[model samples]
Structure formats: C-alpha cells, structure tokens
Target: FKQAETSFNEALRIDPAFVAASAGKAELLEWQGEYSQGMSLLQPLLAAQTDDPAVLTVYARLLRRTGDAGKGMDVLQPLAESGRVSGAPLRQVRFTLGDLSDQLRRYDEAFCWYKLARQYRPNTFSAAAHRRFIDDLLLRFDSKSTQQLNRSGNNSTQPIFIVGMPRSGTSLTEQILAAHPDVFAAGERSHIGRIVQQIAPLRNPTRAVLARHAHAYLNGLGDSSRAAQRFTDKMPLNFLYLGWIAQLFPKARIVWCRRDPRDTGLSCFTTNFIDPALAFSDELEDIALYSNSCVELMAHWQNTLDLTIFELQYESLVREPESILRELLSVLEL
Candidate 1:
C-alpha cells in the first residue's frame, strides 16, 4: 500500500497535470478508507484544472463523504447541466451528480439526473440471451444431475456466497455476517464466475478435473480468507452462478437477498453500477426485465434444486435488523 502511494505521488510530482495519475492516487486513498485525504489532494487540483470532469467527480464524492453534500451538488450540477446540453458527459459524471443531489435530499432532481445517466450509456440488457442461458442451465442441472455432479466438489464448508440482484441489500447482509467472529467479508469478487468460465469449455470434467476447479476457486479467495472459519463473496451477480457454486461448495451457505421488485428496479436504475457488463441497469425497461428474470430464476432454483436457500428481503431487514440478523446468523450456523 505504501509503495503504491509513493509511486502515485512520484507520478504526480513528475507531471502535475496528469489526470490518470491524479485519479489513480484518489482511487488508492478512497480504497484505503481515506476519503478526507483523497478530497484534500483532489480539491486543490480542481482549481487548476477547472474543466476536468474526473477530478471534479472525485472531489464531489469526497465532499459528500465529509458532510459537504451541498458543496458537492454545487460542483456537479453545472457538469450535469453542460452534459445534458451538449451530450458530452460520461454516465459516471451524470451518476455522480445524481448521487450528490440524492445526498442533498433533492430526491426528484436526483431521480431525473439518474434517468439522464441511463440515457448516456449505450449497452442494453438482452432478455432473450439471459432467458436462453437460464433455461439451458436449468435443463442441464436438473435435480438428478445436481445430485450426481455436485457430489464431486470439495466438501469444505468454508465459503459463504451471498447472491442477489444489485441494490438488494447484499452488502448489508455481508456486513451483518462479517460481524460474527468466525466470518470474513470478501467484497464482491468474480471468483466463482471466473471458475465457471474456466470449466465451461469442458464437455464432462472428470472427478479429478472437478476437484481441481474447486481447489482453484478456494485458492482464489486469497491469504486473508484463511484467518476466518468462513468468508463471504457478496457479488450480486453470483446469483447467476448459483448452480456452479452449489456444485463446488455443497455445504456452503447461499443467501438469496431480495427487495420489493419496484423498489429493486428503481434502485438498480438509479445506482451507477461500474461494471460495463451491467449496462442493463442504465435503462428502466432493461433493468426491470433483468430483475424479473432474476425472480424467475430464483423460483426455478427453489422448485428444482434440493438446496435450502435462505431468503433475505430488503424491507424486512431494514424494518427489523436485529430479528433478520439473528435469523441470518442462525441460517449460517454461526
């Protein structure tokens, strides 16, 4: 971490106006939970590079984190307005402005900005492609196949995968679980997805090959995970890879988090999910369709798999965190 900071600082010293270096430094600080430090560095650069959108975004976020949401909104409003007029701003720029508005309690304006942000993005969710994949996987991993194939995976119950749609309280669930002494919080990672991709080309992987896949998945968890009895991968998209996870970690607990479909769609559309692959979230209809597909898939899993899925609803969680958390811990056997 210190080495990275030093390298970033050196790059800035060499070329003070380097936007990439400045953004990299800011990101490094933010990742380390140093919002104020990042803001302090970015704030000065904004005066020199007055029209730099990247600097402005980081500065605005820091301002919001430091309780200067009004100032943050002030910084972003012009950029958002300019982007609207010229159609020049990236989705992130518009999204940051919307977030700032949200922070200032301007719900309506924030929602308007969020919609605009969606317009700026180009990717559309393919409902047909998603449905085809789901149907195909359901056919392949029927109850009988799951019983035969899943038995070959590693028997360790060390991984706890929290799968759900975006903005459906997966992070909150992970946080609550991480509070337990035996649990570790592994933030949203594509380990399981990567495993699926690696093994996808195999026609019928032998038990030895399946064992290798399981080990590779566990190995990817990193050294930090070794300290706890179980660690969580709270990637919401992991909901799509539940069958693979179930096969690899039969004893691993899978928590399916949900929110009211309308609220879930609204939240998904409003939030700026960074992944380019999650572009479906930028459009209302697309996000609604994708979320609905998730609902369908979860239902199919419930009916077909012998797995005991633990459902966590967002509304229930916020209303009764204690009861929900107690039940969550009990489900995890912690």
Candidate 2:
C-alpha cells in the first residue's frame, strides 16, 4: 500500500493535474485511514475536472464517510441533471451516490442515483437487475389497480424484496414477473438497502427513512409510471438491510432468495463484483463466513420485522418458475 501511494504521489508531482494519479493517491490515503488528507487531494482534482464521473464518485464517498451528506449530493447533482453521465464512471458515481443517500436517509435522492445508474448501463448484470427493480417500484407507486392486491390500504408501494447471496436465481424470479403484464420486474433496486443505510443509525427508521426513500424511489422512475402495478427489487444482499426496511415500509414485502450453500459460495468465487462487502471472494473460508453472516442477518430481519418476506429457493425458481410465480402472485394478491 505504501509503495502504491509513493508511486501515485510521484506521478502526481510530475503532472499535478493528472486526474487518475490524484484519484489513486486519494484512494491510497483513504486505505491508509488518512481520510481528511486524502479527501483534500480529491477536492482539487474534482475542482480541476468538474465533470469527471470518477472524481464525483470518490468525492461523494469521501463526503458521505466524513458526515457531509448534502455535499456528496452536490457533487453528483450537476452531472445527474445534465443527463450526460454514462459508461463505467457513471455507474460508479450513481451507485455511490445511491449508497450515500441511503446512509443519510435521502431515499428519494438514493433512488434518483439508482435510477440514473440503471439508465447509464442497463446491460450489466447488476445494472439490469436494478433497473428492472426500480421499474417495478414505480409501477406500484402509481397503480390505481393496487386496490385489489393490497386491499388493506397497505398495498400501494408494497413490495417483496427478494434478497440473498448472488447467483441465487433472484434474476430468474424477476424474469417470471416480467412475463406478467401486471407485475413489473425491478431486478435489483436498492430500496430496502438504502433505507437501512439511511435510518439504521437512528434506532427507529420506521418513521424516518423508509417512507422518504420509497417516495423518492417512486419519483425517480420519471415518465415510466404506468406500466405495471407491483415493483420487486431482487438484490440478494439486501437481506443485510432488511431489518430497517421492514420498519420503514411496513407494507413492503420481502422474499429471501436461498440456494445451496456450496453453490452460492462457488458462484461468488467465480464472479468478480467490485463491492467491498464481497471482500471475502478470494478465500473459501472467508466466503463461508460471509455466507453465514448473510443467513444470520436474514433470520434477524424475519424475526424482528412485522413484514412478511417470503423465502424462495434458487433451485426451485430454476426448476419451477411458473409455479413459483403463481404462488408469489398469490401471495402479493396479483
């Protein structure tokens, strides 16, 4: 790490305006725990390259971590407003901004970031999933037909977030929903996760972030407000954030995607996700540990929250998608 920092610093000394070098140096500093100094370096780079997505993402992260939620949004709001952010950097910024907004209880802002992210590159595995997830949520928020589905006056924006380990067939279930005209497939939106991040610290997010985030998530769907009646975000790891989500959106449904442990471990090992939480990717035992953590967390979510999150095994989804879809629709009253 020290060696990398030295090298990045040397490069920056040689070309002070080098954005990559500056960003690299900032990263090393962050890794070294010198966050403020690292961020100081990033600020100049961001100023020098105002429209660079990478700068916006890293800077936003710095702001969020350092407890400056609004500033982080400020960094990306311009780019978001321009509608020009695209490619990999755009994804990075949007994801981080979404993440930060969740941490700060700005669900609306987080959804905007997530929606923008899905827009920039909806072809990637994660992106496509999230895009579909957001679309589903939007449909629920504006659907007048939901009167029949969630008849308890709790159906509007009510959702069943299917979360678990990746490669767990969350996508397959979403595909089934996509086949139905009334059910929209929001492949992997962060509605639940963002709610947890934003309001978890308050000890009671039920009255805080969940409703705000849901509203924002719905608003972020923009002009696609009339396609479906129910939205389903299927990011599996959302199990970790389920506790807070249930508290916030009591009407929100949950679906925990389960798979054979061995299969989940092997799949994670083979796939390369850049998220730091997946840091257990390089080792077998680490993967097992992380997997166990996920299971434990999901149990907590189920035990504590009043919400009903259905458990769907991946193998079942693969073998009997239609049946599972019918059962799922029955549960949602769709």
Whole-model lDDT values for every prediction: 0.79, 0.65
Clashing residue pair totals per candidate (backbone < 3 A): 0, 17
Kindly list the per-residue Cα lDDT of model 2 for residues 186-205, writing each as its tens digit: 66775556655665455333
What TM-score do all the candidates reach, one by one? 0.86, 0.51
The RMSD (Cα, Å) of candidate 1 is 3.1
Off by over 4 Å in 2: 1-157, 206-210, 225-227
Worst 10 residues of 1 by lDDT: 80-89
Report the backbone clash tally of model 1: 0
> Tens-digit lDDT track for model 1 on 240-309?
8777766666678888999998888888887777686687786777788788878888887777665558
| Candidate 2 structure, TM-score to reference | 0.51
| Model 2 C-alpha RMSD to native | 18.5
